[model samples]
Target chain A: MPVISYIDAVTQALQEEMQRDEKVFVLGEDVGVRGGVFRATDGLYKEFGAERVIDTPLTESAIAGVAIGASVYGMRPVAEMQFADFIMPAYNQIVSEAAKMRYRSNNTWYCPLVIRAPYGGGVHGALYHSQSVEKLFAGVPGLKIVMPSTPYDVKGLLKSAIRDEDPVLFLEHKRCYRLIKGEVPTEDYTVPIGEAEVKREGDDVTVISYGLTLHFALKAAEELEKEGISVHVLDLRTIIPLDKEAILEATVKTGKVLIVHEDNLTGGFGGEVSALISENAFFELDAPIRRLAGPDVPAMPYSPPLEKEFMLNPEKVKTAIRELAEF
Target chain B: MGSEESVMETSRHEALGLSDDQVLEMYRTMLLARKIDERMWLLNRAGKIPFVISCQGQEATQVGAAFALDREKDWLCPYYRDLGMMLVFGQTAKDQMLSAFARAEEPNSAGRQMPGHYGDKRFRVISGSSPVTTQLLHAVGVALAGKMEKKDFVSLTSFGEGSSNQGDFHEGLNFAGVHNLPVIFMCENNKYAISVPIEKQLAGGSVAARGQGYGMPGISVDGNDPLEVYEAVRDAAARARKGEGPTLIEATAYRLVPHSSDDDDRTYREMGEVEEARKKDSLVQFKKYLEDVGILSTESGAELEREIGHIVDEATEYAEQAPYPDPSETYTHVYAE
Candidate 1:
């Protein structure tokens, strides 16, 4: 076992997949020679050369569209979106083109593409940089959205995404890239998509989250353990094709539930999770299903105090968890 | 009328390296597309089909461009009006009929997408959607894949003149030109993007002239002349296969019918203008060229028409009787099984 940063785990997955499958290649704005803006695709250009590791123009639509075309042509392409907020320019290509490729083509054609984007707020990245865009695409049926909270999950889920038959939006929480480090197996392994993991098992309360907030929830659960509050933390690694069975089980384990995320409260992914729990496990709830998320402001602000107010931290998660547990 | 005139007419196809039978086949495909499109319009009028986007006036360009490609190796990302292109690339009248009827057995979308959203893996035709010019980028991707793998294949994508103004048109073409991918961007400038005429659709008033900014040779051909389109596409394909990069082709023609079954051309344009455009119909012009070159006679042309009529009739009957998709399978294929 080797301990690796979340960003290194991403690089490992890409490198191993490219080595394992010759058809697998990478393309994006700075993915090639510059090794990606975050260095997530670092050294891929030198290893795979210019053809395989393509440095594309500044157009996001072309980045998405070209990856789709290559995937349809039997090539596995991993396209980087630089930042998740910038993915709007390529929204049509992803939502309309990549997402609907298989369904619209009557299963005759499918796009096996992985669109990687670094997302989340904090570290002072304001309006243009920080965004939780997964909710915008969660409603789209054909797309699979994966947001991992650890190095191990990132490695396995990304490998699964790249090899998956359909389009997968692999969202990396930029805040978690360097902050989260965990032991990952040096050998080949994969964390399956659409499955939720109970990171901390308890019976008093259930905290479900993904990405950076998932880490905060885990830390909150650990600190609350000293106070005789048993909190169950579930990491929803894959949002789309959500692990409904796991969600139900987590809710049943503890009747009180608190869904946490960094996205806005209204129309956030927490709404869907809350709806699923309420619809299926209505009687299992000991308290009203609560959701703690960013306020419904347009986006994250640039000022430090305002940014902190907008983002979810361990302190916020601890308070939300204690409130749910006591209720 | 004279022997010298006959020789000149025959030489025109020969100079393009087209044999008599091949030229005749091109004519037949163009006519078949026209007949199919005409039947679809009738079906729409009679309420047998839900919609109709015609290839009536642009068959020459579609068929000609398709004929110039290596049918076995090349890929196509054709628009809704590329009926002739689909036929040349291996889509049958039965397939088109199934698509038009939105039957469960249709190869395009199995009743999911609207008719004319062409796609068939067997023939290497990439799937398309209603948003125009997006297929251009998909075609470029296929070409990029081919180039990356060192494969011998070119991708051709077609769109309407109105689609040329789309941001995707700029993005797709700029990417293709930058990468020098083996793709052909053919703009079927039928002079309208759903009733907005060419003047309003194009800022420069020319689609081909925009190719210069993308570093590709752009050419405009008469959409009514199948031979001219064939020659231009053939040269473009040669350049693509040689790694010289993409070519922008503008084949100017008229939209013989309304944009779709839902549109009313009478609201936007005069009936007399449409009637005038019909006189220069590619089907009528190509038939005359074939007859003048001694490849077709009155009897042969009539026989071909009768054969196409029988095929369309059979296709329509079969599609009408084909079953709709079962409700139980509505959620299938969203992801791989």
Candidate 2:
């Protein structure tokens, strides 16, 4: 086992996949030569050269369309949108073209495409930089939404998404890029696309979260461990085609469920998780299902205080779980 | 009575060394496309089909472009109204009917998408959807792959004058130009996008003029003349194979019928205008060329017409009788099984 940062793990997966399969290539603005704006694709251009590591123009739709085209023509394309918010211009291609390709073609054509974007708040990255597009993309069928909280999950899931027969949206929390580090094996491995992991196991209350919020939930569970209360932190690694069975299992075990996310509460992934739990495992729940999410606003603001208010702190998660238990 | 000389064809299709038989084959494909489009409309009226987007007056432009490409090696990303190009690219009359009928046997989509959304992998026809110009981007991407792999294949994508106004079209052509990819962008400027004419759609007044900005050679041809279109696309395909770059071709044709069976052309344009355009119909022009070349006669033309009608009849019957896809199949392809 080796400790690597979340960004490093993504780089490793891309490097390994490209080395193993020549068909796999990367294309986006500032990806080649620049090694990506965040250096997520560092050293790839040097290792693979300009041909495989293509530098595209500033057209997001073309970038996505090229990926769809290349994917259909026996090539695996990993396209990058500089930021999650900027992906709006390319959404028509991803959701309309790439997502519906297989179904529209009766499975005669498949787009083995992966669109990677850095999402979520907490780094004080204003409106354009700190948005989470997973909730927007999760509504689209034929697309897998993979949001990893740790380096190990990022490495494993990025590799799996590359080899998937269909399209996938790989969202990496920008705050977790260099902050989160974990042990990843040197041997070949993959994290299955539609599975969830319980980061910390407990009995009293189950807190379901993903991306950076999962870490908050884990910290809350740890702080509560010092007390007599036990809390289970369920990390939903893949949001779309959500690990329903894992959610039901956590519901059955804890009986007190709390779903949390950094996205606004109105139509967040937490809403879907809560709906599933209430629909499938309602009788098993001891109390009403709870959610701790960002308030309904346009986006994460630039001011630190406003941003902090928008984000769910570990202490807040702790308080929410305590209230759930009291109920 | 000494000797009667039939009007010799001085057309470019003949000058390009296409024998009368080859030219007649082109005519046959164009005729097949027109007949299939006509039949689909009939079905829509009879309540057997739901929609129809016709390639009525653009046969010469589409068939001629497909004729110039390497049928086995080159790829096509045809728009919704590309029945002529599909027929030339090996999509059969039955294939079009299956799609129109939206049955289980439909090769492109198994009763999932609407009619005119065409795609078949075997013919190298890239799948297309209803979004105006998305296929243009896909064609460029496929060409970029071929360029990277050093393949001899060229990708030809077609769209309307209206679609050329889409951002996808600009992005695709610009990207193709930057990379010097093996792509041929064919704009079938059919005078109208639904009801809006070219005057309202284009500011430059010429679609080909925009090609200079993308650094590719752009040419406009008479869509009513198949030979002129064949020459233009043939040259573009050659340039693509030589790795020179992409070429933009504006093939101006008329939309003989309404946009679809659902549209009422009388509300926007007069029947007098359609009748005026019908005199320059490519189908009639190409048939005259075949007759003048001494390869076809009144009797042979009528015979081919009968043969085409029978094929359409059989395809319609088979497709109409075919079953709709199972209800469970709706969820199957949404993700990998």
Top candidate (lDDT): 1
Worst 10 residues of 2 chain B by lDDT: B1-10
lDDT string, candidate 2, A73-152, tens digits: 98999999989989998989998999999888888898998999998888879888999888898899989999999999
lDDT of model 1, residue B291? 91
RMSD of each: 1.3, 2.0
In angstroms, give how far residue A70 of model 2 lies from its true place. 0.4
Model 2: docking quality category: high
TM-score, B chain alone, candidates in order: 0.97, 0.96
For candidate 1, give the lDDT of residue A80: 96
TM-score of each model, in listed order: 0.98, 0.98
TM-score of chain B for predicted candidate 1: 0.97
Candidate 2 stretches greater than 4 Å from native: B1-11
For each candidate, report its DockQ versus the true two-chain complex.
Answer: 0.88, 0.80
Please report, in order, the local distance difference test score of every candidate based on alpha carbons: 0.93, 0.91
Q: Model 2 misses residue A100 by how many Å? A: 1.1
Fnat for the candidates in order: 0.88, 0.80
Candidate 1, residues B108-222, lDDT tens digits: the string is 9899989899999989999999877788889989999999989878999999998899888999999999999999999999988887999888888999999999999989999
**TM-score for candidate 2:** 0.98
